[model samples]
Target chain A: MLRKLFKFHGGVKPQTNKTESTTQPIAQVPLPDRLVIPLHQAVGGHPRPLVAPGDKVFKGQRIGGADGSLSSAVHASTSGIVHDVVPALMPHTSGLTTLSVIIEPDGEDRWGELDKVNYRRTPPDELRDFLRDAGVVGLGGAVFPSYAKLKPGKEGRLKTLVINGAECEPFITCDDLLMRERAADMLKGIVAMRHMLQAEEVLIGIEDNKPEAVAAVQAAIAASGQSGIEAVAIPTRYPAGGAKQLIRVLTGIEVPHGRRSTDFGVQCFNVGTAYSIYEALELGRPLISRVVTVAGNVDRPRNYEVLIGTPMDHVVRQSGARPDSDRYIMGGPMMGVRLPAFGVPVVKATNCILVGSPALFPPPPPEMPCIRCGECAKACPADLAPFEMYWFSRSKNFGKAQEYHLFDCIECGCCSFVCPSHIPLVDYFRFSKSEIWARERDKEASDAARDRFEFKNFRQEREKQEKAEKLAAKAAATREKVAAEGQAGTTSAAAETPDVAAKPAAPSAEDTKRALIAAAMEKARQQKAQVAPKNTEQLSTETQADIAAIEARRAAAATPPTPDA
Target chain B: MLTALLVMTAVALVLGALLGYASLKFKVEGDPLVEKIDAILPQTQCGQCGFPGCRPYATAIASGEADINQCPPGGEEGIRKLADLLGREFKSLSEEHGVEKPKSVAVIDENTCIGCTLCIQACPVDAIVGAAKQLHTVVAGECTGCELCVAPCPVDCIAMEPIVDTLDTWKWRYPVIQIKQAA
Candidate 1:
C-alpha cells in the first residue's frame, strides 16, 4: 500500500556524502589491546561499575550494574581481565572523565550463559527489565535506554510503533547498512517489541535517500508474514531522523514540546535498537558491539562492527585516515560534537566518526551581525524563531529565549547551515538551554536548603517548648504538695515565678547539659590531637594566621551576645 | 438645623464602627518583604553575614538594619538579582562577611572524629548525623555547603571540599564567537 507522509515545519538538505561509506558491507574490527567502556552510556543514572581491577570477566558478562530502574546495565565487550575501574575521558565536548572499566583482552572471546526469553509468554515488565540488564538502548546516537520507553501507553498499548530508519544525517550509513543486510532480524525484533508494547500497527520510516534500505525492509516484512508492519519511504531531509520529526511524519502527530511520544499513544525506536532487541531476546546475546561508520578525510570509508569502548583511532587507522586529518566528530556533521582527542572510545552513542581535515571541513567564516534576514527562522526544523532566540541568548536573557521555546531547537544545525551571515545560531540556543537548566538546578537546591533550615528551627523550638512544659509540670506538683501542707498561695507563686515561668531562670537544665557537653568536648579534643588530620592540623603558615585572626574575631563576638547570633 | 446635626453625627458613628471592624478583620501579621528577601538568600545558615540564619539577615535587610551585600554564599549573581528585585544599586559582596567561593560540601574524617556531637548541634540544617560518643557523618546531599559544621567540630575532623564536575554534571559553555557589528 502506498503511504502518504506528512511534512514537518522546516528542514534543510545538506550534501548527502553517504554513498562512500555504504560501498562495503559491515566489517568486524579486530580486538584492540585494551577497552575503556564508560558506565554512563545512556541518558539516565550512571551505572555502578561491578567489575573491579584484577577481576576475570567474560564476553557478555555484566561489568556495570544498573544504578536505578531508569538506568541500563553495561556488559563486558569481550572476555578479558579488568585492568581497573577508573575515571577516563569520555566522548563529550567538555573533555570530562567518567568512571569506566578498562579491560585487557585475553584473546578468548568467551560468552557467558544467556537466558533467552519467549516474548509471547513473558510478562512485558520482565521483558523490559531483561532489556535494561542487557543494555539495549537507542542506537541512533541518543542512547536512551529502551526499557524506560517500553512502558505501556495510557491506553494500555501503543497505537503506532514508529521505527526510525530515516538516517538523514550526511555521511552516516550505519543504520542504512544494517537495514539492507539484517532487515529480517530487525523485523523479528520489531515484531517482538510490538508484542511487548501491544501495538496495533508499525511503520518503518526510511528516507527516500536510502532506497535499498526501504526496499529491503519492505521485502523483509513481506517475507516475515507480519501483517501490521509496513515500510514507508519519506523525503530526504536533515534531522528527519529525529524521533519527534519521524513520529510527526509517520503518524502525523506532533508530539507536544517536552512531552513523550508515548503520551500520545505512539512510541518510536531506532532500527538498530530493534535489531539489538531481537538479538537479545531470541539469540540470548547482550549488546556489546555495533556497526559504526568511519567516514570523511579517509581514503576508504566503510562501516565496521566495533566493540563498545574500542578506541576511535584504532578504527580510523583501519579506514586509512590521512595524516592531515586533524579532528574527529562523533556523529553527523550537522549535530555531532567534535571529539577532543582520538583516544576517546567508540561508545553506544557513536554512530560515525567523521574524521575532519582543514581541507574536508573548513573553518566557518567570521560571524557577521544578523540582518533580520529570516533565513534562520526559515530553516529551523522545530519551527522556532531562531534569530530572536539567538538575540535573547546572546544577551543572556534566558527567560526570553525560553519564552520562544528554545528547548525545542534540538540543536539540529539547520539554521546554521542556512545562515548567509555564517552565524552559529544553534550554539547560542544550546547555551541558553544549558543556562536555564543550570538555573533550575540551582533554584531546586536553594529551595531544598530553605526547607531543611526551617525544619531544623521548628524542631529546636519544639524541643525548647517541651522542656519548659516539663519543668512547669514539676513545679506545679511541688506547689500542690506545699499547699497540702497549708503553706499556700504567695510563697509558691514567687518560687514558680523565679523558676519555671521565667525564661532566663529556666536555663538550669541547659546549664547542666552545657557543662556536661563541655567536659566531654574537652576530652574529645585531647584525644583528637592524636588523630588530627594532617591537612587540617599542618596548615600553611598563612592559613594558620588566618585561623588565629578568625579566632580573635570569634572571641570578640562572644563579648556582647546577640539573640541566636 | 438641629435635626441635620443629629443625622450627620449618626452617619459619622456608623462609618467609624465599620472602619474599626475592617481593621480588626484583615490585620496582616509579619512583614512580607522579609519573606521575599529571605527567599533570595542562599539559605546557607553559615553565619558569615553576622546573622544566625538566612531569615534573620533577611529581616535585617528588610528593616534597613543591614546592607544587601552581606551574603557571600549568594555571590555577585545573587546580589545582582537582589538589586534588581529591590530597586537598589548593585553592590560588590562585602568582604567583611566572607569572600565568595565555589560551592563545596563538608566531609568528615571518620578516623579523626571523637564522637562529640558538636558539629551536629552546630549544623543549622541538621545535615550532620551521629549520637554523642559515636562517629559523626555529614549527609552530603543536604549539607548545603554552609561551612557551619567545620568550625564547631571539637576534633577538627571536618573539611570543606569543592564539588567536582563530572561528565554528567558538565554543561555546555557559552559559545564564543566574535561578531562584527556595524549597526
Candidate 2:
C-alpha cells in the first residue's frame, strides 16, 4: 500500500558525491596511541569528568557523567589509563578549545561490568535513565540527548513516532549504510522506543534514493511481524532529514515556530539514535564508536566504524587522503564546519570528515552586495524572508531581524546555496544569533547589578530612617524629663516664695548671649595669661637700657598728642 | 428654557460625583519618571553623584537638580544612556566626582590586616565581611569599587583589582575586515 507523502517549501539539489563511500562495506580502523574526548559532546551543558587523571578505565567505562537533564554522559572508547584532563581544541567552526579528557589505550580493550535490563519489566522513566547513562544521543547531526525525546507529549500519549533515516545532505551516507547493515537492530530499537512512547504507530521515513536501505528496513519489519510499524520512502531533498521536515513528510503535520512536535502528539528521532538505544538496552553497551564517512580528495573513500575521540588526522590518512588536502570539514558540504585542525577529536556528533583540496572545493567568489533578489527567500525551507533578515542583520539591527523571525532560520545553507549575488546569508544569520545571545547575557548581568544596587540603596535608607526615628524619640523623652524637673523646682519655690515662681521657665535669649560672650572673653584672657614673654626675662642690661630709651620716646610722643587733643 | 437648564445641572452633578468617586477608587501612585531615570543610571550607589544613593540621584536627575554626568561609576556610557532617556545633550563625565576606570573589586590582604573596623565603617555598600576587631574580607561580588574604604585602612591592605574575563565570560567579538594574505 502506498502512503501519501508531503513536500516541504524549498530546497536545492547539490551533487550527492555519496557513491565513492557507499561502494565498499563499512570498515574498522585501528586504535590510535591516544584518544582525546571532549566532555561536551551534546548540545547542552558540559558533562562533568568522572575519572580523573591516572585512573584505570575500561573500554566502555563511563568517563564523563551527565551534568543535568539536558546533557548526555560520555564513555571511554577503549580500556586505557587516564592521561590528562585539560583544555584541547574541539571540532567547531569557531576553532575554540574546551575541557577534554585524554586517555592512553592499554591495548587490553578490557570490558567493565555490564548489566542488561529487560525492557518489558523496566518502567519507562527508568529505561530513559538507562539510555542517558548509556550515552545515547541523536547521531543525525543535531546530537540531542535521545532520552529527552522519548517522553510522552502534552496529550499524555504520542500518536505517531517518526524515525528519521532520510540521509538528505549531499556527500553524507553514514545513516544509509547503518540502516542497510543493521536494519534488525534498528527495528528492535524502534520497537523499544514505540513501547516507551506508547505511540499509536511508527513510521520510518527514508529518502527514495537509498533503495537498499528501504528494502532492508522493510524486511526487518516483516521479519519482526510488528503491527503499526511501516517504512515510508520520502522524496530525497537537501534537508528532508531535518527533525521538523521529516516530521512533516511522514505525518503531514507542520510544526510551527516556538512550538514542538510533541505539542501535536508527535516526536522524531534519528535511526542511529534508535540503534544506539537498542545496543544500550540489549547489549548493555555505551556509545563508544560510530560509523563515520570519510570522503573528498581521498584516493580510496569509504565509511569506517571509528571510535569516538579518534583524531581526525588518523581517520583522514586511513581513508587514503592526499597530503595536498588544504582543509577539513566535519560534516557534509551543506551544513558542515571547517575544522580548525585535523588533531581535533572525532566527537559523537561527527558523522563525516570531508578532506578538502583547492581543486575539489575552491574558495567562494568575492561577496557582492545584495541586489534585493528574492532567490534566498524562495529557497528558505522555513519560509522566512531571508532578504529582509539579511538587511537588518547587515545593519546590526537585531531587533528588527528578530521581528522577521530570525531565530526560526535553521541555518541550512539553502539560502546561501541559491543566492544569485553569492551572499553568505547563513554566515550573517549565525553572526546575528551569536550577537543576540551575547547581548542577552550582558542584559542579564546589568539587570542583576541593578537589582543589587537598588537593594543596597533601599537598605541604607531604611537604616537611616530607623536611626533618625530613634534620635527623635530620645530627644522627646529628654524634653519631657527636663520639663518635669522644672515643674518640681517651681512648686518647691512656690512653697518658699510665690514671687520667685512667677519668673520665666528658661533664661532669655539676650541674657544667654551676654553670658556666652563674657565666657568667651574670659577664656581669651586666660589664654593670654598662659603665654608669658619668654626671652624678655633673660635680656642683658644694655639691651634693657636701649628698650627703656625707645619707650621714653614713645611716651613723649603720646604726651604731645594728648596735649594737642 | 428654565426646566431644561435645571435638568442639565442635575446631570452634570451626577456625572461629577461619579468622576470624583472613580478618581478615589483607582488612584495611581509612584513616579514613573524616577523609575525610568533609575533604570538608566548604573546602580553603583557610590555617592559620586553628590547624592546619598542611586535612588536619590535618580530622583534628583528626574527633578532637574542633578546633571547626568555626575555619575563616575556609570562613566561616559552611563551619561549617554541618561541623556538619551531624558532627551538631554550628552556631556563628558564630570571630573569632580572621579575619572572613569575599568570595573574593579576590593581585596583585603588578610595577613596585613590589623582587624581594624575603620574600613568597615567607611564602606558604603557594607561589602566587607567580618566582625569588630576581627579580620575583615571584602565580598568581591558585592564590592562596587567605590574606593571609599581604601583611605580608612591604616595598614593599606585593601587593593582594588580589575575584574578579569574568563572563558565563561568571553563573547564573540565583532567581525573585522580580513585582508587575504598571499598564498
Candidate 3:
C-alpha cells in the first residue's frame, strides 16, 4: 500500500556526517570502575534514590524509584555497592549538577531476580506501570518517560502509532544503527506498545538517506508477519526526526501548539524506545544501557552500547578522539551544547558525543547586525518569526516576544544554522523562555504574599469588631443588672412601709428643701450653744462677773449704733 | 411674551422633577473608590501606615486623609500602582513607616520559647499557633513577615528569616560574553 506523505514548513538539510559512525556495528563497552547514574534521567520530577550508601545492590535492582506518575525509575547497571548518593555534574547546557547515585562496581555483574509477565494478559495500565518501572523513556533526545506516551487519550484508543527512525540530525546515527542491528526487537516492542495503546496501525518512518535502516525495518515487519505495521521512507531533512514533524509526515496531521499529538489519535515513539520496551517486557530487563554515537574529530568514529553512567571522557578515549579536539558536544552540531567538562556522566539524553576541533567546527564568526534577511524565517521548522523574536528578546521586551509565539520555537537551531549574521537565535529564545518562567514564579510568590497579608488584615479587623461587640454586650448587661437591683430596692421599701410610700411619695422638692433648712438651723443652734460659756461654770466667780459686765457694755454700744444708723 | 414665560417655567419644573427622581433611582451605594485604593495597597496590615489595617489605610487614602506614600510595606512599586490608580503623583515610600525589606517568614526557637503567649497575641495576622503557656510556632505559609510578633516575645525567640532562592526559584542570569581568542 502506498502511504501518503505530507510536507511540513521550513527545514534545512545540513551536511550529513552520519556515515562515519554507521560504518561500524554497535559495540558494547565494558563496565567502568564506577557508575554515577543521575536520578532525573527523564523529563519529569527527579526519582527518589532507593539504594543508600554502603548498601549492596544487584544488577537490574531498582536504585531509584519513580517519583511520580510521570517519572521513570532507575536501576543498577551492574552489581555494586553504592558508594554515595550525592549531587554530580550532569550533561546540561546550564552546566548544573543533579542528584546522582555513585556505585563502585563489584566486578561480579550478576543478574537479579526477573519476573517476566505476559503483556497481553496484563491490563494496559499495569503494563504502563511495568514499563515505567523498567525505566523506559523516549530515546530520541527528548528522554520523556515512554509510559506517558503509551496511555490513550480521551478518544479511548490510539488510532495510529508512529515509530520515528528518521535519524535526521547530522553526525547522529544511533537510531540508524539501532534499526539495522535490532529491527526485530524494535518490532516486538512496537507490537507490545500497540497492544497497550490498542492502536490500529503502526507506521515506522525513517529518512530515505538511511536506506539500510528502512530495508532492515521492512524485513523485520515482513518476518513478523505484522499486517498493520508499515515501514515508510521519509525525505531526508534536518529535524525530520522531530516527533511532531514525523507525525505530520506519516499521518498528515498538524499537532497544534499546546495540544498533544494523541489528541489527533496519533502517538509517536522512538525506535530505540521501542527496543528498550521489548527488552524490558520480554527479558525482564531494566533500561541501564543505550546506543551512543561517538563521532567528529575522532580517529575512529562509531556507535557504542554504553552503560548509562559511563563518563564521557572514557567514551571519547575509547573512540580514539584526536589530541586537538578541544570541546565535546552531546548532540548533533545543529542543536548540541558544549560540554562543561569531559568527565560528566552519560545521561539517557546523551545520544551523540561530537568531538570538536578547529577544523570540524570552527568558532562561529563574529555576529553582525541582522540585515533583515528572511533566511531564518525560511528555515524555521515551526514557521516562527525568528528575527522579530530576536529583536524583542535582545531588547528584553518579553511581552512582545510572547506575542510572536516565542515558546512555540522548539530550539531546533534551524534558524541559527542558516543565519547569515551568525546569531545564536535559539539562545535568545531560551533566555526569553527562562525569563518568562522566572517572572511567572515571582508573580506567584507575590500573589501568595498578598493573599496572606489581605487575610491577616481581614482577621485583625474581625477580632477588633468582635472585641468591641463583646464590650458593648457586657456594658449593656451591667446596666440591666443595676436597674434590676434598684427596682428590687424600691419594691422592698414599698413593701416594708405602705404609710411611708403614701407620705407624698417620699417628699416633694419644696418640702425636702424646707426640711433640710430646718435641720441645718437646728444643728447651727446646737453648735452655738456648745461654743457659748459652758466652761465658765468651772471658772472663778469674780472672773465670771467681769465677763458678764463686758458683754453688757458691748450690747449697749451695739444697740445705740444700730438706732443711729 | 407672558405665554412664552409660562411655557418655559413649566418645562424647567418638569425637568427638575425628572432629574431629582433619576438621582434617587441611580444613586451608587458603596464606596467603590476605597475598594480600588485598597486593591493597590499591599495588604501587609502591619499598621506602619498609621492606620490600624490595610482597609482603613485605603479608606484614608480614598478620602484624601492619608498620603499615598505612607505605606512602607507596599514599597515604591505599590505606591506607583496606587498613584497610577488614583491619578496622583508618585512619591517614595515614607521613611517614618519603615524600610522595605525582602520577603521573610518568622521562625521560633523552640528551645528558648518560654511558652508565654505574648508572641501569639502580638501577631496581627494570627499566623502564630499555640495556647497560653505553650510553645508557639509560626505558620510559615501564612506569615506576612510583618515583624510584629518579634518584639512582644518575652524570651526574644522569634527570628525573621528571609526566604532563600532555590533551584526552582533561580532565574537565568544574563549570559557572559565569550571573547574568541585571535587565531
DockQ of all predictions against the true structure, Cα-based? 0.36, 0.15, 0.19
**How much of the true contact map at the interface does candidate 1 reproduce, as a fraction?**
0.50
| lDDT of all predictions | 0.88, 0.83, 0.84
| Chain B TM, per prediction | 0.81, 0.78, 0.85
- Model 1 clash pairs are none
TM-score of each: 0.88, 0.77, 0.77
Cα lDDT tens digits for candidate 2, A1-565 = 8998888888778888988889988899899999999888887778999999999999889999998768899999999999999989889866778889999999888889877889989988888888888999999889889888889897668999999999888888898999999999989999989988989999999998999999999999999999999999988888898888888888889998788788898999888888988889899999999999999989988899999999998988888889789989999999998888988999999999999999898866666778888888888889999999988988989999999999999999999898887778888888888889876865665566567655654675576556556655665565567667874434353343322322343334235423433443344345446654555688999998998999998888777566454
Interface RMSD of each: 6.4, 14.0, 22.2
Off by over 4 Å in 2: A464-565, B1-34, B42-183
Docking class of 2: incorrect
lDDT of 1 at A381: 80
Q: Which ranking of candidates, highest DockQ first? A: 1, 3, 2
List, residue by residue over B69-157, the lDDT tens digit for candidate 3: 98776789889889999898999888766567787899999999988887675665677999987888898867777666765666778
Q: Pick the candidate with the highest TM-score.
A: 1
lDDT winner: 1
lDDT, model 3, position B113: 93
DockQ-based CAPRI category assigned to the predicted complex of candidate 3: incorrect
In angstroms, the error of model 3 at B6 is 23
Candidate 1 DockQ category?
A: acceptable
- lDDT: worst 10-residue window of model 2 chain A: A497-506
